[model samples]
Target: MTPTTAPLLPPQKPFDPRTATIAIVTFNRSGLLSKLLDSVLEMEPRPGHVLVVDNASTDDTTEVVEGYRERFGDELVYRRMETNTGGAGGFSEGMRLAYELGSEWIWLMDDDVEVIPDGLARMGRWGERFASVQGRRYDFDGSEFYWQYRLSIPLGIPIPFAPAGFDDSGYREMNSGCFEGMFIHRSVVERIGLPDPRFFIYWDDSVYGWLASRLTRSVIVNEFVLKRTREIKQWDMGTRHLNASSDRYRYYIMRNRGIMQQYFRAHGAYRPALFAVGTAATFAKEIIRLTAVERTVRGTSHLFRGWRDGLKIARDRSFQTMPPLV
Candidate 1:
């Protein structure tokens, strides 16, 4: 068993009915977006509010949302961005809106998902005692565990498949699976703000959760509530090069991680040197592990670019900025 520490939750305060609002960012995915909305609307206790930020999708995502508005009434609020602000930008807007609307918590997710009913019910039960916690669940299968091929560890570790809370307080760093659905408390957001918009894609979720963990406690519940499209999973590990899309993600992952380590160091909380080394090695593994077919066909270059970009970003920015996700 992992030695666990209890999270220092914010001072006990009166529970507000509208404690949390669900926020999802959508871009060019109409079909998946509809399913995600359906799952949340089906929640028993239901979200206090549901907000969607349309990132200038060309598709009729707005039409789908209009249908939901008629059915959901005031329970759902939709915002359309004139330009595509990417995932980080959309998340920032959604979270900021949640705070302004008096949400005690914000449940964040991408549009390509479907929440299991029981998973949400369990999260509510955990929220009673904890300020902010992420419910653990399979990517698609609720009964089975979700697995991922990783570089840090030789064999891929299962995404926390357990019964209830499994003492995650000791886990200083954790990944939010596929960045689908995770419950975050308002207090954590009030302290950490939203994800860094500079990280348009990758590492934004990790950066947000890292800061939140510093402010309050976070946990991964053992209940599944999301499914990734076939293409989405492939895109996650698609490249390691620095380009308009892929390279930017690599840059942020490397640079933001350095920023995280430095933040801890400044607080007199120096982590193991292996922590940084291991991270870089894992990224390298991600680059090399690609099959021959993938290399020739897909042109996977994010790993090499990540190393180069990590150095550049680290050299440029030493500490994370306040009012940013840090």
Candidate 2:
């Protein structure tokens, strides 16, 4: 069966950058966060306000933000969390504040990426036509980030698009998107609510993007907008790119599959056999990578534990409402 498509948003007034708020979530990456803020400040038509959620960084993040405040004045709004809430929780708080601040559009991103000078303006043009839109991301070396692909629910894997999948003339519908350079409108947030902070990390953006797709038209605009500065070389398995993630990341990634499963099952889109096969395939890949590349089977236990625990995680029915940040 074909995937559900987002309906085109009704025509509205012309795009205005001043009505947008850029929401950035950062954790202990003060240097990179400074670069990202510099780029955002250089936008041709800068956003009306920039809301930053510092995820309890034990670094000079506060000092870095203070420098920006002196330069940008009241255009910047900074909130520092008392604990590390991870990416999921940080974004939830930032988006919540942006909505409460009366922003018409909220552009969400991480602190490790630098926005292209004209990227926000171009995205605003598409925002006039679509309720939710995402711009393309490129690597520091200027290559397009190849892994930004739509997820195939049946296979539980990302489906890479051919060159033709990108259309310069218009937006392409998608069911999933990353937080990096994702532009969400106020109406979509009102309809679907804030992203579930329970995820605390992996797959949170995927689930939130999926919710947006179901509620309204979400698309990926065919324009390069943000550049990923960090370079992570994944294990080059012949058929797949196996990430050599840390023990903590491994747990979250494996465990988050259960959350995705719960969401799919409730939506009547679950394919049990296919998901099981997919899960097995992932396990095999990680095992092979650990033995070959890492030269040890050290953290395989976490993988098993995460998978088992994840399956028991229930779906949060009230995920639409934002939770208070500690």
Candidate 3:
């Protein structure tokens, strides 16, 4: 079940509609959300629907969304969750609503990110051109605070340049790692199911990409649509600081990674050795950085919490989903 396989869509399929519904999951960043929505609404092929899922924000997020709704009307669907479901839950609910509302596809973007150079419209074109293409995402990590993951080609071959034309079978042969920017197709969604809510945060997108790669073809386009938010601080931590740090961030990474491993093993596609190597390297990097930033035991505890919680969650299923962040 490679990613290139056809998706399981229902019968009586209509022509592939160019329209896509954009889902923006927002918390308390009303200013950032307003800016994000403004740019998205201005796209050339404006999304057929703009759906916003507010995660129980305490600030003026409601006011901002209402303003957009007053103007956008039927073109937009704004929803408020009874509790703050975190990013993973927000995406899950938003995607579910989009799928139910007859959207041909879904374009997911973070609330804090701002559109640049009309990237959304361009990415939508690319998604249409190569239905398997996963769209593009890049971080504005600044010069000093940068982060990038190494993408390895098969047989440990180094990929120095982009391949010509996505039509080449080898292009399909090489797997694409999922990053932030994603343009999800209907076929892939129908086959692979929605984003895993159990993955409250962290590796949820990566797990989805890995799963979609197994169920249907997926590739990450190099185009940059949204910019990583820099101005906003950690104001939305809310009352569950422990939940945010312990359960969501640290635990899910380990828990989901193991879950994914078990799933792939059942499918006879287990790559534990490869995962082990990658995980070790990642852990090493985090330890070195954490120690350098603050060599205290407190710092170590904060840094290693993800690893600790991930292990705990992997062992206990009850910890997978926290008590709905109200």
Candidate 4:
């Protein structure tokens, strides 16, 4: 609970949704995207704007979003990237565009999550208090989704298990973040820069949130602001859970460590020997999960490959530290 010691700014103001822009990054899953749009349409007070960043989906995603154009008008914007840049890239584009639109706050999400009627308004409650914030979410089964509030960047792990019931403050300080429902102020973006697209997928949000925590008081509130529209097969691990993953997912899960290593080293949090041990331990944990939970190492080779590639990435001298937007 005492992990993040960043100074809380004084004289915070209440957040207003009308001054915030919602950015959803989508790659296929038009059905889920449509439902999310419908949910966004019903959000109270309404957002300043909704921008859908299409990651060159081959499906009818364009048509699905186009259907809502008449009702949304200029309030809705759609930008299709020429190439599929993955979740990390799409979010980077979304945040940059949303900032260009001059919105005071930028809310980032994946298309798979449906917005709650009062989601943005709920986040707005903490707008004046903190520049960066995340809200709670529910799985499609209507169960509370488990998200880590604090992360141990040096070890590349979360500091705690599930939260102890949201507590008295109604919010918990967070160093880890979920892109599914991250609400952040433009000033924070200006101070820390946008989410790095190089991650391509995994650990991107965690690093971004941790960096934000370094600059301001970033928290995850008690409010259920988003509901995951898709269901993931997961194994119950005590109060926490591990989502079943695919080969692609597994590759990124480990391979992205390369990108994370560079960032952590740049921030002075990476210790060579400690990071190596932590990474080896991470590999072992995944192997144990595959053997005990899934009972199969079907794509285990990819994990090894990703680990090798990630090491290569970590040592690339061309890698540069993330730059600030200002």
**By lDDT, who's the top model here?**
4
- State the weakest 10-residue window (summed lDDT) of model 2: 317-326
For residue 25, give model 4's deviation from the true position in Å.
0.8
Q: Candidates' TM-scores?
A: 0.75, 0.88, 0.74, 0.94
Candidate 2 regions exceeding 4 Å error are 1-11, 161-165, 168-170, 235-243, 288-296, 314-326
**Ranked candidates (lDDT, high to low):** 4, 2, 1, 3
Which stretches of model 4 miss by more than 4 angstroms? 1-11, 160-162
For residues 172-277, write the lDDT of model 1, one tens digit per residue: 2343323466677776666656666666665566546555655555555555555554242232322222112244554455555554444444444445565566
Candidate 3 clash figure, as a count: 5
Q: Root-mean-square deviation of each candidate, in angstroms?
A: 6.2, 3.7, 7.6, 2.4
Clashing residue pairs, candidate 4?
13-128
2 or 4, which is superior by TM-score?
4
Q: What lDDT does the true structure give each of the candidates?
A: 0.60, 0.79, 0.59, 0.84
lDDT string for model 3 (1-326, tens) is 65345543222333233357888888998998998888766666577788899999999999888888866778889899999887788888887898888787777777867666577566655554454455434444431111122234111111324342345332332243343456677666766667766666766665565555665545555555667664422212222111113323434554455555444444565565675665555555445433443342343454366566545544554433222111
lDDT by residue for model 4 over 98-179, one digit each (tens)?
9999989899999999988988877887777777888888888888877877876668866656464777889887887778
Off by over 4 Å in 1: 1-17, 141-178, 227-276, 292-301, 317-320, 324-326
